[model samples]
Target: MKYECARVLRGHDGPVFAVRFNEKGTYCMSCGSDRTIRLWNPHREGTDGPTSALMIKTYKGLHGYEIRDVAIENDNSKFVSCGRDKAVFQWDVASGKTIRKFEGHVSSVNAVTYNDDCSVLATASYDSTVRLWDVRARNSFVPIQTLDDFTDSVTSVLVTDHEIVASCVDGFVRTYDLRAGLLTEDNLHHPVTSLAMTSDLNCIVASTTKGHIRLFESKSGVELNAY
Candidate 1:
């Protein structure tokens, strides 16, 4: 595989905590510890020279706290973000206006993921819980299920077709089958920092604090490889 170094977008006064490429792959959205979110057009060529890259536009004032995670809808029309202020904001990408603010998490939200259909959103928080919100319904932010056995905070979460996977500070990764209402598996030797799913939805990649990446079979929750 080959890669090209694109423009370096520099505006945030603090470290960037989360970034998501839009569905069309033409633009990218980012949020950070600076309590701001920025939108960039990565394909725009720089005018001055090769050293410069275009900074398209920016979206600000959506969060009052440090924005930790961002999830863009499939249509690219809207996006959602969670922050340390225990709030989630939904924004219209075109107008950059706050469409709605969902509040429920008692602590900082660490992770956020939108469903494939963009109808539901899942958020993980330091309060050791994951809440699901119906984006289309008003006043529908609620925790469908709470998985509690973590000795520490929940760091990341990924929602799959039939299950939800969450990583905790205790170095354990757990899977909850939404239909079964039970934790299917718990395995790991170090705190998991992030989670990603393969395009086929058959595999899951988890990054741990121990500087290791683990790949697991999504269905059985069995380790396929650990690096």
Candidate 2:
């Protein structure tokens, strides 16, 4: 298959840092250093094919700093944001409202993710910790648990049904089993900047700052290949 750039989404005055689509892929939200999150319609009718995106809405004034990452909840009605502001924000997609603000990180929030149930949110920060938040607990900004075992800043985090996988600036990926309280670390030996699990949950991939990507088995954390 061949692909090409369909649009140059312009709006944010600064570099756009994060972009994501809802479950239905009907809408996409993008954020940047300008602190504004813009929504677009990639599938807008009459575009013919890959063309300029249809701008829908712009969300701003909620964050004091650059928005690092945005995550869509499982239900697609809401989304979350985290970034240099060192806080997490839950926003309503339709009304563009800040449903809640979660705070506590002492440094820039680098990445954020929601669990399958949307009941919990896991946040990674430059403070070298991955914090967990209970989303529905009204104004309860306190983190339920702070995983601070990493010696370096956490760059990315992904939560599964039973474990929390975090990639760090220390050139390694760590998996924490929530039920067994067991910790396992796999040494990529190259600063891991981002990570994600395959849809089948059988494999994972880590991307380093040097432009190298490594693959691994999600279960044993064994090195598979690199490219």
Candidate 3:
């Protein structure tokens, strides 16, 4: 695939820690070290003159410290964000009101995701654990499973129908079976930075702090290739 730099949206005064394209792929939400979450219309039309590449919509005041991560729900109606303030807030995308605030992680929450069915939400934190929340239940937040062997903080977490994968600062990618609570495998030689699952669910793409992106088989924990 050939790509070109269309536009550069320059607004955040600090490094952008995370960016998530909405499910519809029209808008993009970004969080950064500047302690702000800004929405941008990446698809906005451009003029012949030099105009701003992206339009900022809502600057929500949900996080008090540097925003680390943000995740949109499967329905695209609401989103969740966490930051260095040791708090997680669920916000309505339309009204920008904080619908819920989950407080548990002693440090910053680094990652968040909604389950396939949109029933359960998962969050990873600098406290070195992942917490699950029942979205339908009233203010229900709890740590369903804790993988506590990492020597450093858990940087990211990915959940599929069959398994949960967590990347830690200690250069380990640990996969856990959702049903048995067993550690399936630990692969990768560098600290994992991000994770993406293939469409068919047969492979996982993991990016590392050492500037390498690796692919692994979903079941056997085999390293397929790296780029």
Candidate 4:
């Protein structure tokens, strides 16, 4: 397949930790070690072929430290970001305003993902736990369920149909059932840098700093391929 560079997003002073586009794919959002969140147009009109994206807005001062990961809600109205601030913040996409702050993780949050309807959100943290929160519920920021089977920090998390899979720094990927509770664990034997599941919920792909890219059966730890 042929590939080409489309757009370059700039403006953060420090290393960018995460970048994601909304479900509509019209705008892209980025966060970084500079402790700022920026939203920009990924497909701006009347731009030259190699032009940089037009930054729509820049948000600072809310997060105390670097922002690691960002997830745009399915509806395209808001998005969530988590990072070294040890918390998660939901922001209004149009107004660039903070809608809600979910503060509970004692350690830096490594990742965040939302459910199908955006009614639920899941977060992984350096505290070695995975927490699930009700997106629309307020006044109680406590996680509805806490999955803490990992012995080390949880590096990333993916929320599937009815399950939650978390990648751990200790070389394991643990899967939990929202109904059945903890289900199984896959031994990567090397720190798992990230975790992702196929949209059809048939495959799981994981990457590690050791230069390993692996694919597995989503429901089971059965290996399919690796590089």
Q: Candidate 3's error at 216, in angstroms?
A: 1.5
Q: Which pairs of residues collide in candidate 2?
A: none
Task: Tell me the spans in candidate 3 whose CA falls farther than 4 Å from its real position.
Answer: 46-53
- TM-scores of the candidates are 0.90, 0.93, 0.90, 0.93
lDDT by residue for model 3 (1-227), tens: 99877656667887999988877787788889888787877667434334445655656566778898888886778888888898888888888888888877888888888778767777888888888877888655665556666677888888788677878887888787878977865658788887888988888888998899999887787889999
Order of the predicted models by lDDT, top scorer first: 2, 4, 1, 3
Over the stretch 1-227, how does candidate 4's per-residue lDDT look in tens digits?
A: 89887778878898998888777788778999999888888777323345677888887777888999999987778888998879899988778789999888989999998987889999999999899999888777688988889898899888867888889989998888778765788998999999878878889999987999999997768999998
Q: Write the per-residue lDDT of candidate 1 for residues 158-190, one digit (tens) a residue.
A: 877777888888787778877887776567877
- Candidate 2 C-alpha lDDT tens digits along 52-116: 67788888888999999999987778889998978889899889999898989999999999888
RMSD of each: 2.2, 2.1, 2.2, 1.8
- Worst 10-residue lDDT window, candidate 4: 44-53
lDDT of 4 at 212: 93
lDDT of 3 at 77: 84
Please give the lDDT score at residue 148 for candidate 1: 71
Name the top lDDT candidate: 2
Candidate 2 deviant stretches above 4 angstroms: 45-50
Q: Each candidate: how many clashes?
A: 1, 0, 0, 0
Deviation from native of the Cα of residue 195 in model 2, angstroms = 0.7
TM-score of 2: 0.93
